[model samples]
Target: MLNNIGLPGLLLIAVIVLVLFGKGKVSSLMGEVGKGITAFKKGVKDSAEELEKSSADAARDVTPPPSDKDKV
Candidate 1:
């Protein structure tokens, strides 16, 4: 389906979009979209770090306390 829309078709669509929404508006929209993607990526990275820290803490808690058995 996408292969059918060649370069000319893509240019036509872009022209139409520019006409419907001025160049400034389109550029601004694209900038906002990029910012949103960056924010989402940052959020996912932070969440992963937090999960790792919590799991490490849980493992430490589950570990048995050291005892004095057969002291040498």
Candidate 2:
């Protein structure tokens, strides 16, 4: 889809956006979007770590008991 937007088309769209929203609103919106993306990434990383920790704990709790076949 984006490949269809050549340089001239992209420039025209950018000019329209600038005229409609101005620089300040666009920059502020971009900043908020970046922050949201960063926060979502952090949340995913934290959840993955927590899942690893819980799986490790569960594995430790499932050890086999010692057999008495050779208690000499």
Candidate 3:
């Protein structure tokens, strides 16, 4: 059903939305959407960096000191 909405359909919908909401409201809403997207991207990048740091720490090799029982 959605596939039938071509360019004309999209333009008509845009016109109706503009008439109902006006230009300023739409522009501010879009600005808010842009900010949300930027915040989401930053969060994902920070999460990936944290994950890499944790994995690297976990991969480090550590050897225990010689125990007294092993001394001859």
lDDT of 1 by residue, 1-72 (tens): 997999999999999999999999999999999999999999999999999999999988986777788364
Q: How many backbone clashes does candidate 1 have?
A: 0
Question: What stretches of model 1 exceed 4 Å from their correct place?
Answer: 1-3, 64-72
Worst 10 residues of 3 by lDDT: 56-65
- The lDDT values for all models are 0.95, 0.94, 0.95
> For model 2, what is the C-alpha lDDT against the true structure?
0.94
- Winner on TM-score between 1 and 3 is 3
lDDT of 2 by residue, 5-69 (tens): 89999899999998999999999999999999999999999999999999999988896777897
Per-residue lDDT of model 3, residues 1-71, tens digit only: 99999999999999999999999999999999999999999999999999999998877846677999999
Candidate 3 regions off by >4 Å?
62-72
TM-score of each: 0.74, 0.75, 0.84
- The lowest-lDDT stretch of 10 consecutive residues in candidate 2 is 63-72
lDDT at 13 for candidate 2? 93
